[model samples]
Target: MVGSIKSGKSTLTNALFGGDYLKRGAGVVTSIITRIQPGHGLRARLEFKTWDEINADINQALILFSSTPPEDGGGDFDINDEKDRLRLQHDLSRLNTDQLVSDDTLDPNCVLLTEYLSGYDRVKGLVSSEPVTHMFESDDFHKQKDFVGDESLAVYLRDVCLTLEAPRGFGENLEVADCQGSDSTNPLHLVTIQDYLIQTHLIIYVVSSRTGVRRADIRFLNLIKKMGLTKNILFVINCDFSEHETLADLKGLVGRVEKEVGMIFPAPCVFTFSALYNLFKSIDYKGGVEQAIARKDRRRLEQWREENDMVAFSDQQTEKFLKAVIQKVSMDRFALLLVSNLERISSISSGLRDWIRINQDLLKKDAGEVQEAFSKMGKRQEASDQITMVIKDTLDGTTLKLRRNLGNDVERFFDSKSGEIVQDLTRFIRSYNLSIKDYEKDLDASGFLPTLYRIFQTMQQTANLFIAESINPKLVNFVRQEEKKAGDVFEQVAGPYSLMIKDAVKQYQRTMKKLGIKIQDRPFKAVRSPDVDSVKSDARLNIPRLAGTIQYSTRIKTEAILRLSIYKTVKTVKKLLKKPVKEGPDSAMRSLEASVRGIKKQMQESIKDHFLDYKESLKYQYVFKLVDAMSIELYEALTDRMRAFTGNLSDMKGRIENEGLAKDRLAEELASMQTSLNVALKETRALEKLVMIDE
Candidate 1:
């Protein structure tokens, strides 16, 4: 699932499952990806972060309060240190008012800091050296909700895997993931969404009726297109029954959304439904506490049903969406498996029919004629072996050339200094203007340190967005181009060999036909191409974690800020506490410019390290692995087809000679076996026809 916050994704998830297994809220809640799949009974597995991940989260928050980065390039603020903890508390108290939720609460703008400070003692032991896994079964399933719905505990969770008996028609292998909002304030949320998107077979994009289609929706949809995932997406315009006066009003909104979405991708299939209404209707209450809560929601649902006529249409669309999902799960996946098995059946049947014909001809032949027939069969077998060798050598050579060329191309594209992505990021960072005047009011209210922190956050957001918008799309397109190139090259190499294999099969078939054996004459299929779609799941790239270290600078004078207090330092660090107002602002502005330069350097280095890791993954993990797998597939396919025809018949002749059975008795036995094989071939052909029609 993918959408902006408060777009009814969780509600839709519950409606689809026909139960309230997930705890739904109306804000920036669901921080981790939750995967729900069909299983035997109720179960929940919670995966928590490792100690290093926890430390990194704390370091990101504490870096705002720390003076400077250490020599090893880590945060200066240690959680166990008394003075550092005191400084953190002090800094939290004096944080810019605009950055906080309100005077009564801590900063929502910096949720990591706020949650870390409040929940430290509670989660200290929970986060261990290695990652932790906790399982909840049966009656204890509800306990998982506490960790999911609560912001404090949810912060410690990395992911959740829930399994339960789903409604009928839901495949056991099918999984539905409830992902974080696409437009979440946390940059990491977007990164997480992209990661899941790569693995997901279908994306359900939800949009609220109140806001028809926002810029965020278009931007995200555009990104999906660039990732080559626009094909299997289903859009939901989650209707608000209270907002629409009539069915027409809801229909109008749906039309508008579909038109806008069609601009991004053609022929958009949009579904309109009130997820809340469906949720309220789907739940069953036994009695007692559950009944009481159900009563209230039931009343609300009844009112909506009476007031709005669009509920019927919503039901129809919901059914259509479910059917589409079933088709993807059962029909598509099963059809591929079915076709492969049928092809093998066809191959085996053909070989058996040919062997039966050869045996029947031998029964009527004289000893001299039988010897001549054996010689012909021997020549055919030799030719088949030679053909297999040629195909194998050609496939191996082509795969090697593709791997080398693709590796070089990937290396050049992500080269540190002159790479296209590097240059794009460099331009964005150097040209980013950080004017102090934009935050002058907050600067005066909260002093230089707080304002500096805000500036760092602003830059971080901008840079992260830039990468998501520009760099990721470019990488997606580049990988796609390379994938296509590799496919085309392999296709060329496989084309002639495909014909060679077919002619070899045909020659064997003609020899059987000359012996009065009838068989189905049909075109042979080309070699199956390697699945390029694996790039979606295998090659991953996202914005690096730039939140913590963007503000660090060795050039800054931390001692000067420490000697002079918050208010006095704002003036004193500019070289004159008594200087005129204009000159003081000028010196502070100069210092801000220096900080921007330092931030640029940090960002460049971080991106360089990130791409270095990604380059290896793209080459070895995805591209080369894909090539090697394709080579094996090609070799097996060509070898298997010829092997079916050229199987050793000399052993059968040896068995006949050694047993020395009567000729009449042997003929009778062979005729009975031939009759059985013919019946089996007829049945297999019928089944293959059915599979083809279904496909």
Candidate 2:
């Protein structure tokens, strides 16, 4: 169980144990880790010092060293500089030695000298191998000497490490670790918690009802999830109250919290109880008191009222809480043994051994059958000799006899028979080829194409042997005899071979089914309907005729408008030019020529501007159509690729799941096989021993 500081985590722990084994304070009292174990005696050990104590001790040593006079019966040393005095004091404090003095009532001068010299030697031992001045600046010297005298801090750290290493019941069968809560958010705390989560078989997460789960608790939960620890967690929600008045409210609060943090608390059980009430009962039992002290609960009290009484109350409360917590933890440990299924794994493993042993006998029989079938096919040497003899006899005696009986007709008969055999061989090869193609299709459908390819390669060498030796005399005779005896070895062998292939296909199917894979060809089909009527109508009508009619009418209107406007403008220009030439006959002719040139320039500029605008409009329309077409194509392509990628990822996920299951199954089978083999060997050895004993 782990949590942040001041979340009532310590109180919850005390409630679980029914006692208080932690030191609680306002700021951070429990600076280091603390471990509490159940034992016969109540003992504490110290291992280090606190920051405050180290500071006080250094100051005290410095004061003593500065006030003392020098050793030669002279005046006091000039120790006005604070930094130098501190350095000297630190040097003296590191020494390790013992000093013998008369009494505490010695002369003031002797007392000062004794303390100064004693502190100097202690500091010297701490920094013994180095120069005196070096101790003041070294970080290691300060850390070691600073916490040497604080027993509480030392005891806490020592207990924590001891509990972690040897645990609570190193000599017995059970152990319970009561961890302190003050430094719960520290990195050291996280490391210890992570170690336990990975190594320990069980965990009891204790949260306080009053404080609920804090940010640190959430962080701890996330850490556990990240570590993938999903089992054996028990939540103990401690509610330290005696009365039942707010029990419903408490339950409601707990329910709400559980809902909010339900993902984190995947444990089977969650328990709640009050430690304070248990403490009160323990006090009643130990003190033998019938009447209970009832006091009004106030936030604070007057300083002078009752200091010793308050101490007693706190001590009693701490003791009772500790006892209850230990009892609960012990019960939980025992309960885990009863509920867990670890023992059942061993029994199931044994059953698997028996099953494998039975199956091994069947495998051996199948292997013998396979070997026998190969043996009957004959060896290479014997088959070659038989082929050579048959060829020699046919050429020497059988050929001459055939030539004498039928002359050239015998050759024709031989050729015909050979052609017939070739035809049969061709059909056989075609059938085999088809069978192989079908096998490939099956493999592709089952999504085992790669494995099928490997299997084909392995079979390739054996198939090639048939082609290599087909023309040999011995092979031919053997094949003829076998054909006569079994009506074709191919037919005979193919039955068993087909059965084997069928079994393999079934196994592949089963394996894929177990992996939840379903493979099939899903061809894409376009769904758009063609506008048949529109296409037919457009084909039958003459578009050029309609275009010519519309063009002719538009051109006629344009020509008429241009003619009217130009004629009117030219007449106006002529009238103006006629009225402007008033100086002389030569001036009139010059004015008329200038007027005509200006009118022509104006007409040219207007036509140029109109043509430029029309060209720009046509270019913009073309670009817009091109962009639309490209964008549509791009979107369709992207959609297709995304769909393909998603399908591939889904297939990959299924494949991964199948692989994981296969690995688990392989592990189980291997274990079973090993166990069965061991048992058989053991039985055989036992039989040998029996035989020897009988002899």
Which segments of candidate 1 are over 4 A away from where they belong?
Answer: 26-30, 67-90, 99-109, 285-293, 336-345, 352-372, 513-522, 534-587, 648-654, 660-695
Q: lDDT (CA) for every model shown? A: 0.71, 0.35
TM per candidate: 0.85, 0.29
Clashes of 1: 0
Best by lDDT: 1
Across 357-428, the per-residue lDDT of candidate 2 in tens digits comes to 323322233444423322331232233334334433433343244224332322222232343323333333
- In terms of lDDT, the poorest run of 10 residues in model 2 is 543-552
User: Number of clashing residue pairs in every model?
Assistant: 0, 36
Q: What is the per-residue lDDT of model 1 for residues 460-566, given as tens digits with 9 covering 90 to 100?
A: 66787777667776876787687788778877876788788788878877765664545556556666554455323233422232222233333333532433344
Where's the lowest-lDDT run of ten residues in candidate 1? 541-550
Q: In the order shown, what is each candidate's alpha-carbon RMSD? A: 4.9, 40.3
